[model samples]
Target: MNNVDEDNALVNFEDDQADDLDTSLAVDRFRDAVLYGTDWTVRTLLQQIEQGNIDLSPDFQRRDAWSLRNKSRFIESVALQLPIPQIVLAERKEQRGTYIVLDGKQRLLTLAQFAGDFPDDHPLWDESRKVASLRLSGLRVLTDLNGKTYNDFTSLPDLAQMRTQFDNHTIRSALIRNWPDEDYLYEVFIRLNTGSVRLSPQELRQAMKPGPFTAFLSIKSAESVTIQKILGLSAPDFRMRDVDLLLRLIAFSTRLSVYRGNLKQFLDETHEFYNANWGVEQKGMEGLLKRLEDGLIFLCAAFGNERHVGRRYKGDNFESPLNRAVLDVQIASALDENVRRAVEEGRLDLLGTFQKMSINDQEFAQAVAGTTKSITAIRTRYNSWRAALEGVIGQPVQMPELPNG
Candidate 1:
């Protein structure tokens, strides 16, 4: 939850959909619930327990697989005088019996997952620990404010007697419509998923990527299996965050930066670019990748020779500027001239030496702290490095590629 929430902002799913409902007359009533009232999805809670993942016990293999400590905190906070998530009907109607969950899957799932009616893995399902069961037990369906009480599904008069008769209470039914289309479903999913634990765009990208990518993960897992056994370790965490860095690098490398949408779209466009350009002929992308790889390799060589190594390549911070030089190479390449001159000349190595040179030989022992590093100085240093790299690599520096007029 903590990891997922960092990059996303909360979206009010209920408020957005209040005006759009299936029924005309019930619109205001629904609006009242969406706007001022709360109609807890009785069905969602029931479904959650049925899904069989509410085991808080440690021994349970599936206990909090998604790491929902924040969710527990939110629920506890709401219960024990903390600000609760404002009830939002982050759900919408589609066809029937299956509502398009607009914004509240996490909350609904939490409710169902924490309902203390049954043991973690209850047999016979006898003890109903789901929220629906708990909510229905003392079910005094809060009636509408104007006049009548037993208005909608909640305020039925016989529900009290029904609860008294049975040790359990269940919703008679829910009034929601089902929706198809994964994209539409995702929109609803995202809209409804609004909360403090708002998922990152990359997280959403991971969740929404289609079969091939998912299969790639599985294949990678199998490949990593032998590696783990040999090394007695696990795979590295290189998901959307890494992808974001890679995308920026690629964008900068390609000298194109217009395609900015969700992670899915970004990746899709990147893949398309590779397929159309690199994968097909190996002329454009191959050169780009090779130049990037060689530049880094040359940069590393220069760094080692100059006794300035070990700093990792951060794509955005350092590589972005270097990408400008790459764009320069691309321009030189278009002109059919000496390209990749920076890498050939070991410009980055010179820059690294320059940076190290700025600090005292005694102060070099200290980490990169208490130093005023300016962008202009960095650029100047890069130019110095570029001059050196150009001298060594013998490639002409060029600019970013633009559309031919």
Candidate 2:
């Protein structure tokens, strides 16, 4: 995580261009703009949901991020006729005019559960069933309405006014047309959420860009027993730090030299490259997955835990970057399909070689020294490990020609 210097941050800014811009200029640049509209009332949105026009199951920031207390407060906000943040959605790639919520899943979920099961006639409502009524739990402005559910408004004698207020409330929205070639919606989502420190880099990418590559990584990590054995994730770490660690292996191993030392930029570029061909390049993604799987199986066979992966600190925790840098280069250099299989299925033992290299390797030491984030450090550490891996293989391994992206 190299910090961008101050001089570099304002490099894209311009002070003299404010008056020269035109509406047509923006429209021309964003000619791929598909379904651009905003300002929908809650009633209009609900009608769309009921008519089977809206998709509530888009990959969200976090499906279960809102606690009951948070949901309760949100409901209260809507009930009070307050303006909520705009919800954004993208037209589904597979279904024309069908849309998926990009930004406001929690808000929509709370509304659906409160209003009762997406009206039962909606298409997604059956597959994505609403659980039950969510009774209001918290109230700052509407204290008297703290415990009411939507059902109570219809049947009860005293609560009719509250129902009308809730149903008539408005929430703004933005819909992006799912253009074929350009990632207009994805880029918009990234720009909108970049300032949020609440999300991790991978989490944001996974949510913003969903495809086979993302699905593959999630499934692979969930099913890997060996990975869990190697690096037990810390409790309360919901940011998918473990998955990112494995991804670090693939990204750096494949393109070690092209790495410019900024992890956010590196990962952002890598994800864009992978996501660009979501449906059209499934075969390529599968091949990449195969190489990564081979490397993972090989490494697990060679090492036991985090201690074997990186420098052990005095506090007993292992340094993750050093561990990852070493693994990335080692696996990348020897990940020729045949070599990886030989190490994994051929019962080769390189524990002694790795153990000795870990202790005596000067480049490994330099990799973690200074800021483990610079290009110099990345190259040194990865180069050192590549050499170490080659020594164990009893042959010089060739670095693969890889894309800059």
Candidate 3:
């Protein structure tokens, strides 16, 4: 990826102020959680996984991040009766006994894959396939166990005792039940996962709000050549930043009037509602996606594909990294029916108008850069672009009314 693509892939416009809320309130909310400690033997945990009592949500970030060597080392640790970090699970309220793995997913998955008992239809099945009946490697102590799989132990009497020890090895687990709500659970998940191997906000969003709408975002993002070109992404972004941009476009275009400056909450609510009612709202969502794609295609054709969403000042020889704020206003304005027709009819110089504003307009520049997540900044970009387009398009340009807050 070029610098532009790399920058866009890491863009996150959510207001940091949202994260600065009262810590005392947050701590109080977490106090409502009911948790208990227990231990599960390797065989029992794998059995739970096989029986569908434990859910390793497919949308989990870095579900298969562990390498074969790392997995082997973990298995070796279990065989040696070494202490392992406790896993955290949340009991599903809807399905009493069933639980969702909140942390230590890779560890549990490693255990199952090495035992050659991982379910083929599992969420991590594709990654697990590469290490099924995983042969031990990179052993520091029991070097003799190298190159041997779990199945090998069954036929080799010398390794039979080791196999038994592995199966009986108990792992400590913290099971959380009777949470206040999914919101609370989501907070818990965020707190738990924000350690050394942290998940990005988009990753957490996708994992916390899995459903048809989430699936739709992934599929549409992968399929849209126009989106890929405009974002300079040759493939879907692993960090899900591409999807985050798409979500922003959808939310601002369709529900801008409802936005109240909390970008994260706004996006989260949108995901929750649409995911819950996807069957009824699928068609409308698809139409919104198509509109955004059409706007993107037009921008790409008017400006070079690589320069369309990038920022360029009057004196700058090269376009700056993709400006997400520029992306927002440009796409939103391009979606207007009158604006599109004007450009198509050779009446409006869309590219020239965009260049003039980007190079000369101080307020617009700041709106797209500094304090971008603020409601005022968001409104400034849209209103400023609307005025600029109207000046050239020779007519009023419609834009969504933003909230005062």
Q: How much lDDT does each candidate structure score?
A: 0.33, 0.57, 0.73
Mind giving the per-residue lDDT tens digits that candidate 1 earns over 1-405?
232222221221111122111112333333333222433333444543354422112111111223344444433433333334443232333322233223334454444544434454553133323323322111123222112221212456654442232213222222322323234334433455455433323333333332343323223323332212211223322222223323334554453334332324444455445544533534554456445444444434444521122221332223111122222222223222243344354443444433443342322212122221222322333344334435644665453333221
Q: Which stretches of candidate 1 lie over 4 Å from their true place?
A: 1-38, 41-69, 78-83, 86-209, 214-241, 247-268, 271-392, 396-405
Model 3: how far is 224 from its true place, Å? Answer: 5.3
- Clashing pairs in model 3, backbone N/Cα/C closer than 3 A: none
- For 6-125, candidate 2 gives per-residue lDDT tens digits of 232112111111211111124544665665667776667777776657755422222234567888888888878888998988776667766766677668766866774354555445
Candidate 3 lDDT, 1-405, residue by residue in tens:
122244453433332323412122366566777899999999999888777787654443222456678878898899999999999888877788888777787787777677737557666564445543778899998899999998887889999999899999999999998887656665666677454433345655775677899978877876776766665666665555567768878888778888776666788888888899898999988888888888888888777655555454444443544556677788887888989999889998887888788788889877866457778888888888999999887898888777676
Error of 1 at 199 (Å): 8.0
Ranking of all candidate structures by their lDDT, best first: 3, 2, 1
- Name the TM-score of candidate 2: 0.57
> Which run of 10 residues does model 3 get worst, by summed lDDT?
15-24
True-structure RMSD, every candidate: 15.2, 9.4, 5.0
Clashing pairs in 2: 35-177
Please identify which of the two predictions, 2 or 3, would achieve the higher TM-score against the true structure: 3
